[model samples]
Target chain A: MTGGARRADPKPMDVDALIDDPGTKIVVCCGAGGVGKTTTAAALALRAAERGRRTVVITVDPARRLAQSMGLEELDNTPRPVPLPRPVTAGGGSRDGQAARVSGDGQDGQDGQGSLHAMMLDMKRTFDEVVREHADPERARQILANPFYQTLSTSFSGTQEYMAMEKLGQLRQSGEWDLIVVDTPPSRSALDFLDAPKRLGRFLDGRLIRFLGPAGSGTFRLLGAGMNMVGSVVGKIVGTRFLNDLRSFVAAFDTVFGGFQERAERTYRLLRAPGTAFVVVAVPDSDAMREASFFVKRLAEDAMPLAGLVVNRTHPLPTGPGADLSAEWASTAADTLADTHPLAVAALRSHAERVRRRERELWLLERMTSTHPDTRVTEVAARPEDVHDLVGLREIGSALAGDER
Target chain B: MTGKGGTGKTTAATALALALATGGGRVLLMEVEGRQGVASLLGSAPLPYEERVMLSAPGGGSVSVLAADAEAALLEYLEMFYGMRRAGQALTKLGAVDFATTIAPGLRDVLLTGKATEAVRRREGGRRSPGGPHQYDAVVMDAPPTGRIGRFLNVNSEVAGLARMGPIHEHAERAMSVIRSDQARVHFVTLLEEMPAQETRDGIAEVEALGLRPGAVLVNMVGPRLLEGVELTAAAIGELDEVALIDGLRVVGATDPTGLAADLAGEVRSYALRHLLELRVRGELEDVGRPLVELPRLEGGMDRAALTGLARRLSEQGVRK
Candidate 1:
């Protein structure tokens, strides 16, 4: 089916089938802000674990709701086990007919067969940890202790993306869980997350380290004295101590540059690896779709595997013709209640406008998929009830499974 | 134009236009996205391009508004720059023009900046006409947000590495002249929120790197003073009364007056302290070395009264120039 027609034989949420596939490991959920990406990540993980696969979900949202949804008081970078229902399998058995419990240790274990773990990243803390992990303790401590480094670690300029990837790499290498699901921070441009690793990596490799490298030993230092003389003059005019402090910080981190560079390269490769899949999540809005399209094109350029697209909070148009209650209601509201209840009339009009906009968005998305055949599209109906607990998540999972709205 | 969204760049542009108009200098406010944010904020409909549509404020100032849609602007830009309609059609069909004009990262900035520059230059007597070419004394642009603002304003430098010698390169150089000149200024609008503040700081750094001086930093939606004097002192003390304190101590053998009052006071004190800390953080913004102004949050949404009040506050803050 094509051109806005509903798909025949809609695919239900097959957590077991997805977990069993060796090719699938990473599940990335992305969307505009306030679209429930954190809850979606929790639900997907819960569903995977319910199917008897050990799963871990990570969220980069600064909001505490991720921890709150999982019934936890707080969350840090480290993974914590989520208390699953005691009897393991829900509804008695696995629905996909796969083994309820695998017998291995690394891949899966006997009694710990079905488990769930979750982590919420403190981006700045994670960045600091990475520095401490890779660099000399003293050097890392010095950098961490620096006020500028502390600010830059948390400050904007494509740093959050780098930190997100760093956490992803840590989780991927941990071998602690069967499935890893990551929720990215709401970005101004969705593609920034994908481009972040490269942008930051290049900055570290090309400009930052060179400018900050040792003054007397490295190649930069040999040329540094002359540059410094000129820089001093310019720096005075600019009234900033950037060059001086930058040089010191770079010199301090120079010993660890090789390690940092290698790790960044590894992380970049892992993102492009076949085991990783990018699920571009977006709402059905003109601006959101525009950003999503840009993200898809960027992903293609990077050669990262596109798993599918999840269009979240999609307004379900009344499937049949009768849903056109809008036009008739609008006319009646206009005649009898225009001045008496303008707000009510206005709200009705807004709702109709929104429905029309959704139709257009669905059409555009259908057109996008036609050019790229492998890309699958899934729609999640807008939930009036907030998803804040396991029960709410189950409803969301059922929605994803294509249960009737 | 910056890449950062939701910043008050549009609002500042509109207010600045009003300010200049109030000072008896004709001004034009131009928007690139066709968003109607400026018009709506000013309580008017979307203004068409190249037309001097007047906007009247409660204070008796008149400002003209213009909305430059990308397609129409591109066609017009080509007509003016190349003096050929054929080039526009051929470029559009080839998709180079669209990509060059739209999908291009910095092109939007260039076009918006180019339009503002045209408005600025047109103020001087036209080559073919007598007297002052246009009535406007200044042109204000509600640029893109802070994230990409640097790249937008510095598109010429970004592309300079590629287009070294061409009409496009020449056009970029001309645009840069107006952008970097003293007559033109790019102001930034932000709230006191962590992310917006951080973005603003980085934006200042980046814009300076691109050799353009940022005009001012307008802190929009500034919180009103909610606590003061005796009530504030009482709240800070956790509602501890001297009579209750002594009575409770005598009856319940309560040794620590700090117990309930201390806990309550601690929470209130922390909340107040956090606001003070935010103010200190706002203070560090002074390091950017630009004029900083704060606009109090409107109790309601944007309307004529709020805009007038904001314009008055802006004048008091000395952003009227």
Candidate 2:
């Protein structure tokens, strides 16, 4: 089959060794939708914490499964501590160690080597929080109060990405954890999170600046008259006070553009810094691989530090001489039943063919990864059950650590 | 509403348009994404916003294409709503208009839907005017993927919350009338796979919650032929004696001499049978209430020829019926 013959026996994974490696700051888990990215992120963080490194996992996925995995029914915009089993004391008695908590609320906790924290981002809430944190409280409140800002924060194309960075920055600057593991949204918008800060910064620094920045008195009067005339015409046509509201919102938020621009730049710089790393996640399917490749190229183009790739739900072929038994049995059955029972033979043949095809696909994936010498290629076996709790995550983490040769 | 990209939304929409148009109805194929994927699939150049390009199909049917360039469409929208001809000029001057229209999420969606509504209302022929084509018999939209489709189609709700009681609100109400009507429909295209199927379910629930009609579900890349009957059972095969089976095989035996030949042939046949069964199980696509149609997997990707073949297959699958 693919990857040469499989190992004689399945190897045990070294979760502790991988988690303790100081260079591994980012753990990106990407795959097609519903492939357990959220579970992977939580497990990675759990593994890190178990190794005595303070860890925080953040997810921007709208699904509540991430929170539920941490035993919380729901999460908010801020980071909360998740309750983990306290380490055993040297005396063989359990000490009342720090509580592990996971929160959706967008606040950072203090740095600790033995603790774990988790959070889910509320995109719009995080964006508003960023604005409120950077601008004068009154100005921020005014902007938040504006209907346009409300819509823009929630529905804007790059806003989720920008907000994700803002949330990451908060965690990074907090120094609350030794390592941060982020579970990005599914492949659909994950890349946007990487590109969002720069795009948003450009938007703020360019057109937004021109539209909302201070204008010369003479220019203001001329523009105001022009705006008024246009508004009157549009009012007649579409019959709305849209122009008037837009004007007021622009005028109110104009003064804060400089602050917004600065924060966006800071967030962008944080993402590009060496302290952070980008992990690309994908499944073995063609669609997922295409997105992963695009993301890898985009990361290179943007000069982002790509750590490696984490291919999830990879099918593990059975190993050794016994691996071909199913095929041999099918062929023998096929010949015996060729005339007496064509359908049974056909069914067996089909099953064997599917397994062989999957092997070929796996081989192609390995070939695709050959060009990236530096990027580590890791695969997680497809689990028989969905991962939903600490035990499941631990199993996933063990599989991810690779076979202990 | 399928989460998978390149599933065949454009092809289905195009086929539906052709079906309507050939049945003696005028059709408008609107594309929200600026990719011009639909036009390209139809072997025509990209169309501009507010302009119509006639597409004569090989089957003696015709369709029209309209591309909603977000920036230009937004400018047209501003002009139509606010008598702001200079607004477009102003946006161009600041170089913000293009970015605003294209990069702004939901803005493009609003403009595209607004334009569709406008097309629905634009009269084909006045009572006294003869010989003019009807305004439009059907509008087929190759919408965004399922992830944001709900928000994309329901732009009116967001806009209405902002622009209450004005002409904008009035227009939004009018657009809602068309969207909420049975005449307007949304179909999802997905592969009969796990993830895409799950997303389709979620997308349908979300779309229905937003008060939009979820029409047919098109399952693409269905498996080919399947082998059926008693031959599928193990007992029938076990009944054969080894010697008898070998002699029977020898009687019809073909020449074969190669290294690893037996294993390789078995592998190839095994693979073929697996796909057949996969295709068969995929045919049970009853997860959604909409009629399920199957599109066979083409050997090549969705190029022009592939798309035409897909359209023809879709017609043969009785999409109109």
Candidate 3:
């Protein structure tokens, strides 16, 4: 798909079949902000579970609506089972990932046999967990209590990306569910999720860090003899106390640094693996489509598995026997009809506006498709209300699967 | 000002800058995120740390823009506080500047705030040469998104790790005072949608929690309120007639009136939903207790001219005053 003569149009992404396939273990919903990415991930996960796949959704979006939609008061770092829609809410089954995987036997009147678990990525908490799990108590305490470490753990620039990758790897290794759906973090650039681990790893192993690592490790340290001069130069400028503190923090973090590189590499390989499919969600606006195309091009460059595009809140053109009325004609007519019929006048005005907007959206989408000719796209029309409940999600799911509008 | 991702805060901030500068007062519009949002919004080249003229407002004033880089901020800080250029250069060599700005997000925010609020508090020109002419009458920053607005502005928290006495700590505390003082107001920009409205409510609370008063809520991209209080509820239930609309379009010389009718019917449904959603969002902003400014959705997709129109609207709405 990345390198070839492209078809006139890409295949529509089949969400249900993708989930049902045992080979597809990881589904990453990534896109620009305000493009309904969180909603797409939640709906896809919900649909997957209902279709008899033991699915767990891990969303890094800071928005709390995912929990709200599932009727859970909140979701933290740990995965919480969302209550099923069945009337027998007091425990009609579905406890573990295993028992929840029920076969199809017509036992699905209201609720599906599959299970859905969700967790909000708490980056600091995940970092804390990683430190606690990786280091001995004394070492972990020393590292965590360091002022620099405290700042880095809580508000470091690439921390969210690194921790999200860490969490994804943790979930994959936990062997809990058959399929896992991951939502990209709220970072403006969707590629941040992909670039974070490596960036974090580099910072960990970078020149300053190596200069600050234990003096004893200098025998093998590649900075080679000028390290002390560089260190002293920094120490002289920042004051010896601050440099000493930073050095100590780096020394304490050295053990975790190598582990970080390893974990990042593992996750990077996992992302490039065959089982992973990236679903880029976007609204039909020009900026959104441009970002979506950027994402497509980046994923292609990285050789990540591209599973087509999911265009959300798309404005479909008016379709009937003959839906070819030009917006200019509608505008002229609306202007003429404005005096007597206010409601119809307003309606015509809106018709003209909608037609113009839909045309722009199609023009942009075509521009995107022209660049990547074989890119598959599924268009989901906008919902009047926010999808706050499972029914709304199911409607979205049906829309995603082409079963409903 | 800040709001949720994709809430058009950058555009609003630019317009606000233009509006504030319309009275012959120079305004500095700073963007800290390196998103180049202000540059694109103003149709200027990518802004460096140096202040450059972006636009001259219609009335009389001018707006200057700056993408406040952390490194340049730290250098500026050093030059102003310590009077040592060599030490700043040395630190930059050690990657400490990069580490402080990009590596430590909180510290980077402190630098961003320290620089911007410094400009805000400046008396036209340098305080040393007091009353000659002001650098800017006001400073408007296109801050981080609503989710991190609190953290970005919380200089006290950023200083908490620095043991109470260092220059960095002192700088943070001073920045905190300026930010929390009556001199500063953190405005919010949001859309008339559920997520953005909810985020705006929470964001206002967060700003207040940081001991800062919230500013106006600039609601962007608002569509026309064609359906009134009771009309929306009626429209949502499919009561708006499609056939009559089709006949009216035919009578008015529209080609293919049936398709236009279908489009109008669908549009009415969408508009009704938006109306209902917008009504609830208005209530949410009201609960935030800040004055609200409603900017209409631009007709031809908010080009530079339309952005100027929005600035004029904001000025009319008394946003600058």
Candidate 4:
């Protein structure tokens, strides 16, 4: 049990303090799949809102339960007001409400009653909105109509990441919410939340688009004979019409969004801004922790402002006076009681199992802290039931804020 | 195999491969997501695009793994189908490979499904020839998660509108046949959680709508049930007999028996609540009408031994080898 003990314990992450800070305009929760990134982001948003900072949360791919918890029945692409169940306390629960009021930036005065708005990212619709906002109606229609754009808008791998950033940019520029919490797409693609915009930009402006653009584009002319041979081979493989549609789509997209790279770069810089904080969420398992470590390092490499790591669903040692009971003792007692006390045997066995799980979780978290010593971490104890409502979200919020049971 | 993310889809696929490989059967465990999850689960180095024996089960059976990516599959497709290796290189240089695989992922899916189905169709005698002894007894694909599996496996329909008359189109058609044929079984891996179970049900519906065969619904990471029947219900409602619990702990020669009993009672109550939820979810999953195979939760995460243990469990649960 003491195997995970370190020379000095890692710093505990101050989740309440982080959310309560007015300077923290954006909190992006990113992690691998099924690590409760959406739930964390939602809980943080709800916490931020109840703490008197108007917040909006954007979930890239929310399960129905999350949407329902936020009072959203369907994904409607735009932010809809989530009726904040009235704060239990009169003056709100935040430590420093004065700072939030001082930093209110002349937005809608909710009279210190913080508001929360929730939205699910409709990736294709968001892409269409970008086109509509940037391009003229005709070019937008043309790009929208193109079969290649249709597929790229909806089915492409990095499009979700790109659209997420694009939507984030739109939300930030709107300046309607004091805090914006973003639930990124799951898995390695969550890191794409940072890289996807640039990748999409690079892809859009890459030589392939130039080669496939049009027959007489200036860049194509520069390639000369080798280009023709390659073009013919590609033509033979993908069919001439497919290439033609791609060319037209690329040409139109280029004309519409002339400097997507620059916009992507802007969003990238925005993420690195002091106002933003990246929280990498993970469960106690090795796979999720590895991904979380990768995400932490990725954020560090990119100079992004990382707040901390949230280890969700951790099996902490059970509370009560008997918490000090050793696993070995419990198992031994269970074995001795096997004949006489079936219930005691079952209870002691379960206690041993829980103790073993806690040890394993601690070991995994210790490995992470040892590797990323500078990273702050907060552990959310495993809830017995699934979190699917506002009350559940509040419980998670309390756990996140280090409120010990 | 498909399931919600982190539903042990990869682990289930590996175990299923091991199960199918049980009797000297050669099984190809392929992952298209490029996570190299199979490699990691096998505790081996990351697998390359080529299929190689990653693990050997008992009875002389073996599991070969392939971490198939779209770019490699497309390059291979171009080379094998059109003899345009140099042209494929050109595409790579020009980033058309990236475009085809990443920017337009339908084509990527087409190539990926094409590669998997190509493995399914490949004969032992030669690369070009169609008829011979089967190369592998069974091919298990760790496919995309439930959310995207319908579109991932429905390659031909997605490509039909894009590549109307090319080798890509023809390749997608071939893959679709293998996918839609009786040979394929799209197994779904899910936990007894609301979201995963919901996704499994919906995923089955989507796959069935795409005309793919829905196989077993594997419930992974099912937790231990401490109490059952009337006691389980009583515990769930916070009505556990505390005096009996404390007496039992005292009889076991426990120190601070009262405190320990209270702690254990709390644990039991929570477990009962969770068990009830799991039972509801289990009922819903059973209503999905597929064979539901439940795998117990493997504590301390998965390793090679636990994976093989899961394979044995699958066999015991009547999963066909």
Candidate 5:
């Protein structure tokens, strides 16, 4: 009980200042699955666009969920303009309680009228594009048609992460928008987004792949006759057709493997570059906080520029019974009055549950603060209604900017 | 059972296992993610790949838990095959094994399904020891989330990755056979939220498309609607006299009711909104034509007592039957 007591509030993250600044170009929201990473990225993008910056948000969720929320029929691999409530001029305090200062310095190299665009990653389509662009006509067709290639493009574990990076790099190189917001895939570990490219790169060019390719294809066959004999025996078990499909797939893809590796490394560098910001989103619970803490440490270790943390769905205990009248005391008093006031009893019981939940949230918060000390943090209160539109996103953006209401 | 992340897959799977074990039948609770979520939920030590009995039900039945790691499972698979030390070295270096099991979703499902089915069919010696029963009458798997479940269980898709009509292909075919058979069931543990509900719908559709068995949908963490119909309507329409709630609060030890009244009103409003949302989700879930079970939100948090409470609910809800 003593350990869970509230402490002085930690420093709040200045999200408006971060987004409003002319220097910032990219904001990446990364977190564990179901932690509101997609929602956070969308809200941040909407906020940025409304603040008069040409901004584009990309989400890896295939549901076209963001598009539906923004009132658009659908969105694809290409960025489609999301209609804003108002044309954002060089006005101060535009939309909700957003940051008033829209930085006189023009980052978009256009008029101060802000624009927002959104797109959902079509991973296989993106991979197909990469192949079509990198490989020649004949080789690309062969690689794309291979049974193993089709499966790898579709169901391979890291394909989403790899395609996300590819798309991010492509979006940046296009120079269409001043700011880009990326919603990472809902991986169990935030670090998976960072390690995926490398893991896949290694897997693609590993010695095993080389050995697995047809023995007479290239220099990769170091195991010599012994390997072919083993392959033949396994071939008999799995059948020669399966072996031939895998070999042909590998042989055809061997040409474009270098392009994949180079692009992966390029994206890795882009993530760590200056002007790119990583925002870790989490809910104020033990599981969420633990994942957030790991994200903070990982970004630090990898030297990626982290903007701050956005703690979502926080419940501020109902504020009655005087500011000094702690939730604990109110709960105790409610317990004492349970016999006389039955309805009050129910309300108080609910209050007690809220108090207990708040204490646990605070405990997790305190641990996070103690561990990171210097990391900027902001929180969004739990909203009663689900957010699905520009208006709702603005409220969330306001909340992220420390409005709290 | 599995749903979206944070949909309480572990909780539902554990409770289902507990519910089944309540009838003097042995049950196996397994988690393949290695998150130790099952162990933490049961208030027990972290589970290794090896099986161990975690707790016993009031009905004199026991539930054992296992947390299987991919590396260990792959090694076990390899041991059954060549049993070559050099082969293990070469495979581990290239991570070809992990690739086939983890990175490659197709083969990963094959391995996971194979191991789980094995547990389901294992026969234990008649003699009982301190570790509890070696055999289980039933096995419950905490499966991958909806996003991956389709690929993870889609054996037909992965079978095309290699040559067909061989023993390896037959092995995968056998796993798929079990999945599609009446013996195996895939249930969904979801919340009333739109995302979860929609995902559940899509997942069930996918399962049906692949001709796999889709079981009941358990809606976990359904918050209670405290106020009655008229009270809720009054609250929603802002006709509920705040002064009345204030008076009710004042009758208690609380002298101040302004903040409390506002909070109370807000809670009522949210409750009304949530009630409607649940109705919509309920219709969608029912449309799936499978059994639907609604588990009340546990105010006491996910502790051992709460686990037992949910298990009891499962039993009453006819999930174990």
Candidate 6:
């Protein structure tokens, strides 16, 4: 896997087994944007609960209907219970097996039923909460009122990812859920999710921040004596008024709260823990697969537990009666019969297109698998409609679990 | 152009550039995300920090692409505005440059938008004279996704409360004037799906709230309607004249038409369902009250030829420079 040794066939990712194992405490689905990471997280959490685990899903930005499906109307940074779709049949075949397997876990008194909760990350509220929790009311109010703090809390690039990390740590510490499915923010690059916390941490603990801290602070007193040139230069560049505001913001923030880097480090270690698994979600496109490969390599380099890759929205291989017909033959036949039988021509044309698309998709998948042959892989067929409800999520879950195509 | 992540914003921006480059229009295609998506799509080497001619369009016009880096842009901004290249280098050594450009909440966006708007306002013959001809006929930016576009473009408001009078604030003001003017139009590219369409609508509203003009809604990757109206209805019901299809397949000299007919019918059913959903989304997009330009889903995938085809389609749809 390190040197790109190709595997004849990539191992299949067993999502069910990973979720069913109580040892897997955290499952983080991360990948490029619009690759169905959020839906995958929701579906994984739902499936984990259905299979008898106390599960909670933290989605960064879900579609309205998806949020509604999880019984979350607003992003209040609080988890709400999602009523599990009733079992298909009481004490049915698989239900009995599920209950028997999950009977030993008495964390919740629902007997055979597992519980699920979901929450969307409100980054601003989460950041504000951190301030209020760390500082006294007056200082908290002042910090919240600071224009720089408002900008950082509301529109900062890394705030969402940082807050997501904060919320995940909070959830994990609360011991409310046995399995936490975390959906990374839809950053421009998937690496943003992994890099943001560290970036924010670095910024927080950086020399510039220390230099800009209140004059009485340790670093400021130690270095400010010799850094007047730097301060004046920065002041000239950004204006004295703005610099003062930033200094005060930093001062207040420092006096009340510290060690953002420590929290980020703790979460990084938690992510590296064996109990955590990273599922890189992608689609069968060149850009997304390429991003997925980057993520896979990064996860490996970081010593994180790489569960597998979930290739969503993939076109399944062409199968059934016309399976043997090559695309060229179908296309040529369709072209020849174009004037006479429009219906048959349409059918043939579609079959040719489907065959060709599946071929290309498989080629893309092969490129990914060849790069990381040891990584487990799963493919979910592209759904015609967006997943809008619990049932849609369940269908996706089954597809993810390899229960169906 | 901004859209939901992974909705082919770069592709659409490239196609738009190619389309604008026709008829001797000099087009500058800019990608701010640092993905080099334009370079990859054009099959060119990685784009350098400086602008370079990436493609020559059909009508003797060309597209010069710049993969804008915020750090480089900040250095350029300092040198151009304050003649502080030495000071900039010093700040870089002290890590304050990185702090200001990268970690400073709104300053990075200020630099990015400043660079882009400067390009827009740049005059020919390396002069800033108002009467001089413009450098490029048009400029297209592959901006951040919809979630961040408003903040990325509304730099003045972002810094209005922070830096009230410094060069940063002045540059933000200049950039915002250019961004909010009639010359700048924030087009949205989206897929004909629920999430992307919804996001496009919300993005349009958000930009409007910031007083930026909303441009056309470029719908990317719209699938074709393969089945006829009646056939689609029947397919949706899972009863798509299968016997007739089998007969037709037999007439087309198929050795085994039964399985082929059934498989094709299944495909038609799925297609019909998807097409209906697309129609619903299109209807929703129409309610946003912006011009809609639909680009077809290329059969294989996006390549140079497919991109050219898309450019031709955009031209045919009357998308002008």
TM-score of each: 0.55, 0.74, 0.89, 0.95, 0.90, 0.94
Q: Considering chain A alone, report the TM-score of candidate 6 relative to the true chain A.
A: 0.90
TM-scores of the first chain across all predictions?
Answer: 0.80, 0.78, 0.87, 0.92, 0.88, 0.90
> In candidate 6 chain A, what residue range of length 10 has the lowest lDDT sum?
A95-104
Which candidate number maximizes lDDT?
A: 6
DockQ of 4: 0.65
Best candidate, TM-score: 4
Best-to-worst order by DockQ is: 6, 4, 5, 3, 2, 1
**Candidate 5 vs candidate 6: which has greater DockQ?**
6
- Alpha carbon lDDT of residue B164, candidate 2? 61
Show the colliding residue pairs in model 5.
A93-A100, A242-B162, A242-B163
- Model 3 off-target regions past 4 Å? A1-11, A84-113, A213-247, B43-45, B75-94, B123-127, B242-247, B253-263
In model 4, what lDDT does residue A274 have?
89
Compute the lDDT of residue A39 as modeled in candidate 1: 72
- Listed in order, the DockQ scores are 0.03, 0.20, 0.38, 0.65, 0.46, 0.66
Candidate 6 lDDT score at position B62: 92
Residue pairs clashing in model 3 are B124-B134, B124-B135, B125-B134
- Across A93-205, the per-residue lDDT of candidate 6 in tens digits comes to 22232232222222452554576778889999999999999999999998999988888888777778889988988988887678999999988789998888888887777
Model 6, B1-321: lDDT tens per residue? Answer: 999987989999999999999888899999998888988887788889988888888979999999998999988877887787887886787678777776676788888888899899998877647789999999999999998898889888778878888778888888888998989999999998888899999999999998899999999988656777787778878878888889888987888788778777877777788887888899999999999998987768677788889999999999888
lDDT tens string, model 3, A351-378?
6666666666666677888898778888
Q: Which ten residues in a row have the lowest lDDT in candidate 5 chain B?
A: B125-134
A86-138: candidate 2 lDDT, tens digit per residue: 43222311212223323212232233344566778788888777677667988
